[model samples]
Target: MASTVIAVLEVTLSWLFANAKGRDAKSFFTRPALANFPEQSITVTSPDCGASGSKLQVDYTQDGTGRFPALQWSAPIEVAAQVKEWLLVSEDPDAPLPTPIIHGIYTAIPASKTSVNTDDFTVVDQAKALMRGGFHYGRSRNGLPYIPPRPLMNHGPHRYFFIVVAINEELDSELLKAETTREQVAEAIEGKVLGWGMWVGVAERKWE
Candidate 1:
């Protein structure tokens, strides 16, 4: 299972490890520190995103800061008690950390609820919408309805992965209601995952 930050250390940690001035073949970078998954790149598409949606080409930008209200999914939910529409945003793992930061953990959306635009970001309206739609909000690491990505300075660019997963079995909603990490969610949905889609956004603070 995956777990999810780091402080301002250096932008070249991984790079420095790769090309140490004096090291033998058995030294650090030559040896594996952890296991990894096979890479599968996700694509993104928007009106301004043009015709292609490859990895760096699909950038997640802010028209201005404090832009925290929108969602555009490509699929609809199936009507079933066991079927749930789940959303999550996770930080990259390479940064020094004990667990990956969880940006969002929303679940149980109404089958008819497809997206949330800027106009729908109000707390009261969102609550009303969720209540009307029978949705549930889950643990967010930052304790906000939503926290825009703010990767630390010198931590290098972080890949914020926003994913929509179809969970086709009943889950422990109680556990997800409190503090939860990305790995916990991953473990919960392991064999129960019906389908999944993903989008990636890069964020970083310029080092002074």
Candidate 2:
């Protein structure tokens, strides 16, 4: 009974303090490590979520399959030719926290690749993915490679930024493992980032 009461209070407090007008991924880039990276002409799109600034489908969030959505992207000819690898980060700056809540960290993507399907990132199929690629995954806040959006109930809309970074140098393989943290990924890419692009998808929890 005591634990139950505590859980209820925790939920209530979170709901009460939630910001209805939450910030988006652009705010996330203001951090010192990322502030210098130029915004390049990379086109990132998702068929599952329509387009940037569009509402994310339930199928990609905690409400449904919770799979990482399929994504496609292209870098400029010069950038592509120089890029040694690509890094993808998904996070929610609107989350009621001091820092954005990281949803996923997928790195070491081959420079030759331009797209990824759900099969390439669904955590359940990670073993299969390892057999087919040179890419690696970094642990999210929940200790998994991906955590689908799960905004607090009544917290209004939360934007999930799928930020794709083009890196001129290959990230240290040691820092691209399952135990790696977001800070580590940021550190690994600090001066190596050539540029980046982003796609934003919004989700909100209206029901408990």
Candidate 3:
């Protein structure tokens, strides 16, 4: 009886807290690590997403219900050549847990003779598109997209980083034509990096 009463009290307290804040009590309890993020020299922006911008949406899960925002960046002139086989990597350094989360990885942007203006998400031409098979970007388990059964909550707000790397040589057009992993793309660009840039955004969904 005593334990039952304690449980009831706990539930009531949680309920009150949830109502007081406009979020779930559990969400309120979680500590989002927005402060301890790594410093980056480059600046990133998304013309199609963010509260102040165009606000394009990104679905976080396979159910396609919850969505995050789509992001883009402005490429500087020095990094333009490397953009041809560019690799965009997003990572959270300060996960509440040990291992950092890799939120997104996109590759194979067109090499820009000039700087890429903001709002350029897709490759400019058919030839520059990441080959259909291996180049598509998303969360994949063993190279296949599999949505998790249970959501990983309480992880705090994850920092989504987008990095652009310039490659030295033209990748194997035949291998790229067949589709390749971002790792392979990185391998192709290993020696010839000209310049790189990165930007970050924060996101998290906690249960109340």
Candidate 4:
């Protein structure tokens, strides 16, 4: 019985040590920067994307059912003819260490739409139908579909950023057609942006 107790203790210790190490590693990762752009400059708000209702909000916990809230600006920052493409992205600056985690990337939203519904991130409909069919917001790896992965432990309140970028030219029809990496979408939209709007949301998991 003593030997069994010792074995159980060892197992428990091992698990605790591993969890500590993982948390430590996560802490080492630098979180992404909070959105500095002003609210008046843009037209949308999301709870998961900002500190308040007026900003974009990103829920840290992926309930598998909760969708990312969306806000829309009243007008396009640039004319449709000047826009080459549209891009949407979400980043958690608070993510630990090596890199900030990218929660979502969507390319090819048309310039015409004034706003996207929060449910638009996952649902297929007339609004999404207007954009390039392949590149909708909140797509996950392997075309598996997106499900937010809420951290088990809230590292304070993490900021979730949502950006809508209007680019100058259609850069990557090939990759966009093939389903490119989130990084690729970023790369394609770099520098060519005519205008961009952003929102922020805060999330922290509560321990009971």
Candidate 5:
């Protein structure tokens, strides 16, 4: 009977300890930078080669789903600096808006990983759901998932920048409320913007 009680206490203690660390890991987005954080390199990739600044068709489809373009990046991105979290941001600079239109805001990408595989919506969605406790996907302007660009008639080709940045600290869910903008995410990771990699993809709409 005494051994049983001890076993229960041990398990309870271990669970408590893990939750405490989890809290710290999830607190990065809310913590302010006390000093400048060092920079570390991270590579962002996509199966869709936009290196020529090519245009991404809005009606594009992949695996029976809206083509969200697969994005891959370097993994275990430890410059051995103060870093843990990563943020995936996609925005269009020329969307006829006051500021660039934000398309996606995904945070808490594990540092011990690589390749987001956005091409597989199921994969990304599963990750988003599992990470609900610590990570979040900020909604776009239209309150949708990572969105592809759709320019108006003759709006010309729009430059969409897909940026992958590493953060020195873990982010908190509270810091990333629904419909959070990239600017806001930037602000949160500003001082601690350890490193980043970006790929620019172009999209245009032609009106006859």
Candidate 6:
């Protein structure tokens, strides 16, 4: 009987420790610089994400094809004539880590464009192809083209943010290279921001 009680205590303690770390994690949207930056808010939309705050379809998740969905955003208020390029970043702040997970970082989207088709990134030489077609794919947190949403089971719903930033000038060559960190991308675009916007999609994994 005493062994049974000890076993229960050990399991309880381990669960508490794991949950504490997740609760302490911070959202990327709440970062001081982004939260305080002065910019116009554009509208972002995805067919896979029916509406803001809606449940993301399984097709776009790790459980499915894990395809990067088509995305569109409103042009910056300042207009294409003044904007040099745009940056698209997707992340999940509810990840049980110190910083949110960076799903993808795509930059150099031509200022004249406001939408990307679903098949854009599936090319053989995605980076070079994207560059020729008007955008480039930067290395994601996993060093892959994209990371599909895969929240921890029983962690409740996680909010995935698709953030878009309009820039006054092209991003530096260094920032567009492989294996770029979120901090580096954020800092490089700091003073160059002309406007920004975001769309949120929620996903949850239930414990079996």
Which candidate number maximizes lDDT? 2
lDDT (CA) per prediction: 0.44, 0.76, 0.41, 0.50, 0.57, 0.70
Better of 3 and 5 by lDDT: 5
RMSD (Cα, Å) for all candidates, in order, is: 9.8, 3.5, 10.8, 8.1, 19.1, 5.7
lDDT of 2: 0.76
Estimate, for each residue in 90-168, the C-alpha lDDT of model 1 and write its tens digit: 3343334544555555555544455544333334444332322244445566666455666545555565555555555
Clashing pairs in 3: 24-208, 25-208, 26-208, 58-68, 82-166
Candidate 3 stretches greater than 4 Å from native = 1-42, 51-68, 81-83, 94-99, 113-151, 174-182
Per-residue alpha-carbon lDDT of model 2 for 114-169, expressed as tens digits? 78877787444464223134577877888766799988766678889888888899
Model 4, span 1-208: residue lDDT tens: 9956655664554445432322222211111111222232334554344434242223334644556565565335444457756666665655443444667666676666656655565445433322333345434443433436453342444555566665667655564432456656555555565556666665655333
In model 2, pairs of residues that clash are: none
Among residues 3 or more apart in sequence or in different chains, the pairs in candidate 1 whose N, CA or C atoms overlap within 3 Å are 2-183, 3-100, 4-99, 4-100
The parts of candidate 1 lying over 4 Å away from their true place are 1-64, 75-84, 118-121, 125-134, 170-184
Distance from true position, residue 18, model 3, in Å? 22
Q: Over all chains combined, what TM-score does candidate 2 have?
A: 0.84
Which model is ahead, 2 or 5, in terms of TM-score? 2
Measured with C-alpha atoms, the lDDT of residue 28 in candidate 3 is 9
lDDT string, candidate 3, 1-208, tens digits: 9956655664554444432322221220111211122333234565434432131233533235433334444555555534455545544443433333444454544554222332233333445443322343433223332221112343444444445555546556644431344445445555555555555454444345
Sort every candidate by lDDT, greatest first.
2, 6, 5, 4, 1, 3
- Candidate 4, residue 68: how far the Cα is off, in Å: 1.9
Model 1 lDDT-worst window of ten: 26-35
Q: Which digits, one per residue and each the tens of the lDDT, describe model 6 over residues 47-154?
A: 656777788888878978786666788864555557889888888877767677889878888888887765766545644525434576777778877788977655
> Over all chains combined, what TM-score does candidate 3 have?
0.51
Which of 2 and 6 is ahead in TM-score?
2
lDDT score at residue 110, model 5, on the 0-100 scale: 71
- Show where candidate 2 strays beyond 4 Å: 1-11, 20-28, 31-33, 38-40, 123-133
